[model samples]
Target chain A: MKNINLLAMLSLLAILWSCGDDDDAKPAEFGTFQVYFDNKVGADDITRRDNGSTEYDFETSTGEKFNLSLLGYYVSKITLEGPNGEYFQDEMKASASEAKGYYHVLEGESASQNIKLEQVPAGTYNKITFAIGVEEDGVLEGAAGGVLDPADGAWFWNWNAGYIGFALEGTAENSGQEYVDWGGGRETLENTFAIHIGGWKDVADNENFINNIKTITLDFGTTVKVGPDLSPLAHLVTDAMKVLDGAAIDFSNTFSVHAPKAGKPFAEQLPQVFSVHHVHQSTSGHD
Target chain B: MISKTKKYLVYGWVLFLFWSCSDDDAASPKDIYAFEKPAHFPDATYTFENNPITKEGFELGKKLFFDPILSRDKSVSCNNCHQQSRAFADSPLHPTSIGVDNRVGIRNAPPLANLAFMQEFFWDGGVTHLDFVPINAIESDVEMDETLVNVVKKLNEHDEYPLLFEKAFGVKEITSPFMLHAISQFTAMMVSAGSRYDKYVLEGTALSNEEMAGMKLFEKKCATCHSGELFSDFSYRNNGLNDSFGDLGRGRITEDEADHGKFRVPSLRNAELTAPYMHNARFLTLEEVLDHYDGGMVDSPTLDPLFKDGDQVVGISLTTEEKTSIIAFIKTLTDRDFIAEPKFRNND
Candidate 1:
């Protein structure tokens, strides 16, 4: 009778062990999402001219007509906040070989126009936060490879070392006819104005100053659901003229900014520039 | 119940996991004498706690320092300009150190010693951290002429470097950060605190009569700038070497007209061995440098006030006899033992 009892107990234990011991312990499900940045000056689409000469035709909020030849900046360290305290943090990785997190937003470049994120926790996300440029940690790292490499020439300042956050190179008819050679000699552009917005901040009691703002957040206008059957898209637009808004200083007086004193006023307006235009979601549920 | 063998195995595995986790502890010292600092000297400026030095890490760093693989043409190593025998200063004949493809650098190569206490790197102090110093040399068109990205590729492709990198930093793939940290490990090890002057000051060792006189003169005449046991106040100032700026020095780095012609006050450690002095290597000998300081100073807008009296540049008030005695004192700072430390040599 005791042997039979022991056999019955062993069978009971076996059955309990077979009840999804590990697999059922909170399985993780992920889905895909896209963050698209629409670049513009005011009402017109922005385009970048790499060589020779190219023109960007756009109007300001005050209906002031201007043309741009170059417009580029870095969009890095993105964070997607989901409902229920679930969040997807980008790896924030870049090397000489490839980039995992950083995106270079150019006027006409499609490679960086849409930032694709995968393995985002399947949920309804309401907020997206990102950095407009490389952080101090990234800048002082020294000898970066890949997207962060200083040799890219388009991004970093070589001698007085730092990265240019918002670089706009072009000629404006309202530039007071100040024709000068840009950057020692890129070309003798006429009636041109260049705004290379880059600056660094110093911490209290610290002697060193670092240039890169870490936090720029945007609400997705509406909720974005990402699931097995639901893939959402968030469209955010970058307006260049906003850097000049409420700056108190007129553009005709000073247009070039290479350091903090001239650039801080503009950097203060950068966080205000990122706003979600629209979000798209399908009606299908998780399949 | 589990078998005794299985129970023992489980216990062993847990112990192993705990032991491996100890590596992540930040407070624990990696080595008893990793960064040997003198008691008389000020605290090291480097954040040593973040990237603690180990025996394996230092060894790997020494190898990279001696290797020419970082150069674009594979013909120039850091040791080419910074040789151990010359106290890691550029060779006296080469005012500007020769780089890959026989290119010439604009400024003289500065000595690499007691750098942990320095506030900045280069004549202009363009680089703030010790980790960032090597990058400038590596990317200079007239220096290594190599991009750091290419260096990573070369290191990853090499058979032994990847393994060495793994041993230093537990990553299977070699990275730029780990490589830079390992290099700093080697550089920070170059502590020249055991010099005769340090021995006399901190250890109460005896000094010669001439050496003692030189010490007094150095204290009174030059100590305001070249102060402390590390022999530098870490300030950037113009010494009135030129009436106008050519290289712009600190001004070029700061982009301020007031800072123009100003250069970092270099440490006087191993001054005897690092001759062909000044940023341009214009002064060949200790005597010539003293002569320039004693008189021959040009007036500049950014000249340090210490070297000037009203409109005229007073320079240092020193007799010929005092200059000779000061040279005797500066020679005492050459730490032979520190330069010849076997651990810093290329063993690989």
Candidate 2:
């Protein structure tokens, strides 16, 4: 009777150990989500022109003819939300060598437009939110690397000591920019316009200080599942016309906008500029 | 349970003995290269965790500081404007900074010392971070006239710099942040806390009778703006510099009409060596600066209220004797040890 009881006890212990092993076999599910920024001027696709290009490819709401030579904006602090309280916040870190969350989506850079976020918990996310510009937190990190490195084509304003949030450089037909010799092989051509929007400092006591960093949120219009087997890509459209029209920019008068107060209107229009064009749940590979 | 409690007490006692031994080792002294805060001074404002100071990094920064390679034409460097002999301030000959191609800067290059404590940089307080400060000088048309992209490229192409950078930051390729970090490591180590006033505060060293009297008067009158151990409240004030604004000064940065002609209250440390004072290098001597305070001030809309007594703009009521005493006191702030420190010298 004693021998039979010992055998039964040993069998029960083995069964429990196997059950624990079975639970450990399956890990928590995580996946990747791709955010594709499709930049456009109204309904037409954007084709970047040279700095001195006279051929105006786009027209504003006010019927002002212009062509983009350079255009870009920084995006950071991305978050995805679901209807059933599922939330995923992208990690933010600014070290000497890396600025993790900040993304400089520039025109003509095809690889820079596609932002791939990895290690996202498997869930059905319906809404996406992100800041249009590098905010106070990004600036206060002192020195940063990757896209935030000013040495490597980062649009940084030296005197003001902040990154240019959004930049639109082009030649407008009605631009009043006079030709000037900057010396040392640098020149500002006639009819050329450059609008650089920056300044994150917003002191509480100082009312005049402008914080032009803007946040934008867009609904997917349809829920997309994210898992190891399925990866969702959100296609967002950025319309430059919305900013030019919404701000009611007169190309002649409002040509050079490099300051924070001057860029307030342009930054304010950032929310309406970005929209969810479409989303795709691809089984494999990044587009 | 009683035996377990007794065992924990015995373990704690042994650990305490080891901790005490380690504490004694730490108390003996720190390395000369290591950044140590003077007990009298406030905590450093620099973010050390991001770029911790190493011997190699500090040396690289020092090399960069004195190198003319940062300039567009390789004709100017930080040392060209900020010399060590003048306490890292520009020479009195150059009222404002004389940059590359003999191009003159508008504002005076203020002395560089105890920068780790400063919250802002430049006369207008435009730059909030010390790392960002060099970029202004490098990119300024009147100064270096070199773009940061070009500077990084130049450094990368150099034979020794790439390897030096690797040793300093442990990176295979050179980047701007690492370069900036290396510079910060050197500048942050420039802690000028060995002045006579500091010694008097920390070690109870005696000051001359005149200096003591000046100290008392300064505490009574000037301490409102230039307060604390580091000196200067770091507030922006017009100080009745001018009636009209040529350079908007602080207003240019803030875009506020009220901030016109307001510049940061500069620290008085090494004030004796740093001649041609104020934002525009208006005052030639310490006596002239005191004279400006004693009725030579030009009134402005944004003039500091401290200088104003109702409708009458009364600058500080300082007699000639009082001025002499204040100058004597201010001279005590000159740190000979800091200027003569051989480690800061450019060996190459």
Candidate 3:
């Protein structure tokens, strides 16, 4: 009877200790975080697509005027970072059979106006980072479904065997290639400058070309405080002018970069296009 | 019925045990199907990091290489263009590489030897990676002309291939990267460093006075471009085959006018067997190739600087004696052991 009373007293103390620990260390809550990529030609947001009848003028950092027809590129492997090293990663990945992380922020897809990142660990996230294109492993995996799916068209160079990670179709009279007219009243200038920068495979003994993985990281600078009461919305502005800003190859004359040698200049400057313009934060984590 | 089922299970377990033991039965795992990298040869550029070359993977790769199932119509195989007899080059039957639907290839199919040291592939050097070379051929309109997805689907559907793939890679469903890697393992293992010339260099083997003279002649005239231990520096240069471009060659890939008419420097190893020579199979024989270097070179702006001595022609100077001796020396590069390697032959 003396031993039994002692055991009972110990068990009661254990339950009290567990309850005290739960009240002291309450688990943090999490919610969905939305990231929006807003495209712009200078200060003006691209709102109009004037079929072939009208061409929108885009002025580069070099102050050279060119007309753009289509402007969209893939952004993949999105990662979110907290100041205190709190980490949350997405499990889904894009492949030749299925598209998971592949997001093509198209011109008029307000339907997917923002990429919804679900169940982000509830905390103050200072930055967002993502790869500009898919790495070589994804490129060599052949065809995939969704945004990476070639059935969507104009992304893959079938004969050459590579995915065009960053594609910008436009027209310049001085651009030293033939004009591409995609009917719908869509007509580029006499010369079309198609910048398709992508290559993650080596060609033997060619020192003057890019034969390795090309992935540029875009880190959002603005601080975002996310919690259960607040799922922060980060606005990222990507400008096409930044791609050719102080670029090695003058896009004015030698514009079209289909191969690695020509595409290296633009691939180097891919990060300049992205920046976090604003962030919405809420106060709920600290209690 | 239970006794009969028990007997079958015992038999099945025995077979599985036997099958598993065979792979491990070899002397050392690495030595089972060892890759040859000669002392004088440069380090292999194609690193098998994720895809280690194994006996089963190499065998599966060889099977896939020789198998016609990878082709669209089941008529064309990698072996069709890349024949083992001609040193993994085009057979004499194919003047130029012929593909499915009897389609004509643009350039002459080059030989496959010492590819581990090679950085780029193709006459135009369009393909940077050796593993990617098969994809180009498989997808080309005139070649196999099948989608990579379709090829994967077909391979996965096959009864034997999935098991072979499982044996090579643990995955039940095969992927394109594994396919490319397995094939690369087979291609990379094809080392031609055991030639008589190689033995002569390393072991100081006896050579005839004619071959010795030819070696001297080759060093004096041809060694600059085909300099390395592999006999080719693996560079793309315009050897000035023509004043006007029939095919833009490297220019087609690079899109630079300066690169026009340039072709990859073909390795002279086993040159006696691989003919006709040049990108377009322009030369019917090595004698013709020597003759072209001797006199037939046409002046073009994109011509290699080695060919031009300030607007004056600097073609290879060779006499009848020199040519014969050079041919003799070149013949010594034909590695008999590599061609006769029993493991590379069709198992079936």
Candidate 4:
């Protein structure tokens, strides 16, 4: 009788262990946050439209007067920091058609784009982190579905490879009435412009990460505005322009990055050109 | 006896594994061409970033190259004159290519091989790069007679092109860059470095006595300008073919009278295959070409200084036997592998 009971217990334990080995668990949930890019050069300035086009005039600290035309980029690998030091992450890959927005920005004016997250484990989040451009790995290794899909135009469809991160084109009156265009395509990752502002490597690593992270607090039922000012991301754009302006990116050397054999290095000398501004955030109460 | 909970767990694990594996095994968009450098050749100057190679893009380009849709009246394609057997040159019988409405071009179609090494394109060298050469061919009144905008529009209207573009470029929309890149990829892959002469150089094989004698004669007389791994130095030379034609060769592009009657040195590779040679296809056979070199040289102010001497005059003292030997050597340049390769063949 004792042996029979022991055998039955062992069998029951085995059955329980097998039953617990379930792999299909629901993915965790993450909270959503909004990024707002404010293009207001002055406190009370509204863009006036002439015909079908609207223009905004602004000057850089360097006195480079520009009429802003288009300003858009790709944002992926979204993550949020919670109050208890917990973090929730969501990877929303951009489709190819969606990726097309990275090629050109909307004309004149500030805009807010929402990043939706699902199954995010509900928590108090303090920070939002995401990449400003398409990551190298995602481009080199390839991504499926989501925002990085070719159908979304997030990828560099015209070039038959890679993606474009940030495209800013406008007319610059200060620079001899020349056109100011700064954009990086995903075809060659090593040649993509890096926005490193301030400080030498021996002194301080002030290199702005292509992956921009902003810390903000969010309650379970609240809305948070991520970016209303272009200052924080301005360094990236300016640095890219500086690289392009300096004639540092050799078209022949870094033309393709399809494989590792095409060993082209990422642009390192970028801090000499761009400057970064302060990041601000505002929160709204939700019911 | 497994409980219901145990069964559910097993099912869940299976589902999880299935999904994870599926995610991992997701297919990457296929590339157009698997660009492999030949062991005998040097590194290719062309890079992939500007126009990455993909299978679909190459196939699409090949389809376009062989299709008459590029013509104004849908009567000609790039292949109408540049047939494969003739080493991608114009048919010897047709001195000039016939275009839409039976329009005739001024120059004969040159063999399309080893173009990546060329610094300039066309006999006049008007176009500088291979990427831009197709534009002239597609848009010229004597060639395809189609516009880039119309070609893109037609491709967009096609049922198969959108998907083909998506497969090659990861986009459903057809683009000018994608179209050009695809064609360039196909053209770049049309390399011809496998002739019997190449075998003698690479494999240390012996050439026939006739071919050997011909090689000596070529080195003595012709190798000065036609010297390089690609046969032609890609320089414009006044080979004394004509004192003047209505079209004044390189002079038209430079708008300089000094460059009159100058044309790019044609490569001798596959010379036997592409007959009725020269920019105008005036010579019908190797004998005629030799005859031109022997005694039919035209006198002009811009004649190449190399041929100014009596030895280089219209009629060189070459017996019929020497001409035969030189012809035999030229035939060694015919690359059977290049024409027979499936890569250059029509994919569709």
Candidate 5:
């Protein structure tokens, strides 16, 4: 009887050990999502010609005039908010590089690039949060390493020690009937030509944070998928530009222009700019 | 039952120990020192963002400084011109620095100590920051004669360099920023405030009679321009080296005729040790430098009015004894502790 009892105990211990190993095992799952920025018809699309000529093409709501040439700015800090408020953030920051992040959208061309976010935790997300340009506070704090490395020329001011957030380079038609090429550093303290739209203290008053707090609802049901409509974000950016120009507002100092302890003008303008694009979802989700 | 409970407790403790050890191993390396500023000096113009100072980064920089691989033919290192004993400046014998392939440079290689405090670099002040200074030395036709891309590639290819990069930055791949940062870590560490002159100012130490006399003379003449603790106002002035080297120093950068003969005033901290004076390396000894200061001022359109009379003729009149005393006073500026410090030496 004693021998039988000892055998039963040993067998039960072995079974429990196997069960513990099985409980630790987990399956890997990943989901796909896209974020967009529309920059079509919100502000004046100023172009500078090769012969120092400047021209301004204003955007009209009725007819969609494609102004794809004026579509180059850095977007970073991409995060996705799920249905349950669970967040999935990307570790990789995007910037212009010789091998990557170089986008030049010509006139009448589709000005959009698709970025793949691999190894994202499988979940349903609602709102997509990201900064329009590199964060102003990040630059001021002297944060090193990432897409904003000064050596990469993404954050270069020639001699000054700061980065340009939104570099809009092209020809603009000046009062002299000549095309004046305007390129400004993101920080516009000294030189007047460039609309440097970044400063930590009064960035909102100084910068046009006209396109912050964008939302997109996404649902993934266990499948490897490529969703269309990622290109709509580019349209939103253009529309926001039109709204910005209609207001006759200076994006550079929209938040705070002179002082550090000032409030951003984003509260007054974000509603008008983002209202142009209503939330659109795809029925055939898997592509 | 007690035996069974003890066994479970031991297993739990063993698991906890393993995890705790792993967590400790995963923690990142801490920075050894915070950025320190001298009380006597103003706020530094160049902060360490491009090249953060870490122990490993600083050590790597010291290695690169001594390594001759920076040159095209592996003939001359930065140390060949910048010797520590002579306060990191060229010797009096060689007026112009001889580079790879026996190529002689136009200007004298200045001392590489106390550069963290400097605003502009080189006599011309063409280069702005310490991070960019190595590029001037590496790319110049007469200096290293190696491109930055090639230098970066060479360092990346080295067997030991990948590990060094991993230690400094958490990445194995060698980058231009990492390389520059490492070099800067070493360069920024070159502080020289332990000189007898510093002791006299800080510790109330007494100076020799000749040094005292020279100090008085320096106060009257030199202090107007070469002012403050670092011994330079960090401004470009035409000290009348020559009316023409065909090399319009600071004017090349600004494109202004007023800055034609102007060069950044060099710090006199290690002036006694770094001989062969002037921007073009024209003077051989301190005596020659004193003679030039005494009577060698050249009259030009943009010459500094400090030495200018009603007619603006070149020269400051100093007696021979006064010049000797000035040289004596300059010798007290040498910081022996700085030259002999093993931390600045090449680890490799």
Candidate 6:
């Protein structure tokens, strides 16, 4: 009877210790986080025009007028970081059927602009990092579904065998493109320009190939609390003028950039194009 | 002197053992469909995990390969340029590809074999994966002249393709990746490793005296570029084919002046059957190709250094006897079984 009493006392002490450990460190809570991309040209919002429309909405520093028919970029590898070593990385995987952790943010598509990340560990995040183009891992995974599928409107390069990371297609006032009726259902516009920034080869000994994928990190300037009750939204502004004006583009000669070497100058200015506009900590969900 | 019942029991036991051994060795269903890597080959580079080879998937890919519905007006198919009779290369009648609407292709249609072991495709090595190679042919204006989206729509509308796709991939809706993956499953299994040269290397089969002499000459004169068991090292080098770049070759892909006039070194497996060689089909026979290496090379800034000796432009010095022997050895690389395999033929 005395030995049984001693065993019962030890079991009671074990239960008390477990309860004390739970009280000291409660379970981590998770909430939603959203990132909004706002595309702009200089100080005005992007106004997408027709493919061959000549009415220019933007002018370069060299006084070359151009109007965009399509403006978009591939965003991937999103991450949230905090000052206190709190971090969250979005999951990335590609298979024959689906491609996860990739977003094709296009102009005039409001639904595509908002990127929602869920199950983030509750913390105070102050910085956001993302990639502007599909990296080598994304392209090396062979044919994929969702946003990376070419049949489903992925900006893919068939000859070079890679995805166009960033695309700017429009009409320029002094473009060198000429109209060609190829006797089929295909024809080139008279003054249209197409700038496709692609190429993902990074050979160790070869310097001829160009890899134009760029990653950008921005500071929110203020921290926002994230928890089960609080959902945070980060507003980011992407300025296209940094690509054209910063590169000192002359549309007469610099209009067509379909190759990697031709697109290097525009891709070099991508790091400075994105910046954080504001941060909102709200009880309601993202709008 | 043995009893009749005892004799029957012994015969039945012997027959049962014989049947079981043969089934395990040859008649097993799994063994026929499996992608068996040849013992002499290097590891395959295909992403088989993304799309494992199933019997149904292979069948679907073969049907698609033979179907001309992939073209714009159903005028051509992959089989038009790639014929199984010529080891999946074009016949000698058409040096380059003769595509839809009688459009003449700029480059020669290369042979397809040992594709799972390859890292890149095309003469310029632009495509890096086997799955993405078909998109170029299907969308090239001189080739299929059909859009990828339209091809998918046509397949969906076909009465038989939808059910075949469902059986292969277990999907309600047909997609490009699945289609590409199915094609890869068929192409990757086209492993060419049963040649006479393969037997000579693997099973110690003796070559003729002439073939042996040619192989020795080949090792000395050509092994710098065509080094490994696969014959070619898969490098892009301008073999002094032209001085002025009409096609621009690899330079168009890299946009680098140094890479001008460069094309991929093709594998010599089954080279005897795949005639009219080179990226532009410059040579009509193996003898002509060897002659080009000896003296016909023109001078160019980007010519392969193998053809140069301190700017003297000294091509490979091969005598007539050596060239004859090398040709004999090269013919041994042709695998008769691969081209004549009934399973690789179109069923429908």
Off by over 4 Å in 3: A1-131, A134-162, A168-195, A199-221, A225-272, A280-287, B1-30
**In angstroms, how far off is B91's CA in candidate 4?**
1.1
Q: 2 or 3, which is superior by DockQ?
A: 2
Question: In model 5, which runs have C-alpha deviations exceeding 4 angstroms?
Answer: A1-287, B1-39
Residue lDDT tens for model 5, A67-142 = 2233344555656655664566766422111212222222232333334444455555545554444443343333
* Number of the candidate with higher TM-score, 4 or 6: 6
How big a share of the true inter-chain contacts is recovered in candidate 1? 0.11
Highest TM-score: give the candidate number: 2
Please write out the lDDT profile of model 3 over residues B39-149, one tens digit for every residue. 989998766654568888999989989987877888888988888888899986677888888998888889998887886778877665566677787777677866666
Error of 4 at A196 (Å): 40
All candidates' TM-scores? 0.73, 0.91, 0.71, 0.52, 0.58, 0.90
Higher-TM-score candidate of 2 and 6: 2
Per-residue lDDT of candidate 2, residues A82-172 (tens digit):
8887777899887778889889998778788999888777889999999877887777778999889998877888888899988899998
Worst 10 residues of 2 chain B by lDDT: B19-28
Q: What's the best-to-worst order under DockQ?
A: 2, 6, 1, 3, 5, 4
Judge the docking of candidate 4 as incorrect, acceptable, medium or high: incorrect
Better of 1 and 5 by TM-score: 1
For residue B337, give model 1's deviation from the true position in Å. 1.1
Clash numbers, per candidate = 6, 0, 8, 46, 56, 0
All candidates: DockQ: 0.15, 0.36, 0.09, 0.03, 0.04, 0.26
Better of 1 and 4 by DockQ: 1
Off by more than 4 A, model 2:
A1-27, A283-287, B1-28
Q: What lDDT tens digits, residue by residue, belong to model 2 across residues B266-294?
A: 99999999999999999999999999999
Tell me the deviation in Å of residue A169 in model 5.
16
lDDT per residue as tens, model 6, A82-178: 8997788988877777878899999898888888888888999999999988888888788888898899999899999988888888998988888
Better of 5 and 6 by lDDT: 6
For model 5 chain B, where is the 10-residue window of minimal lDDT? Answer: B23-32
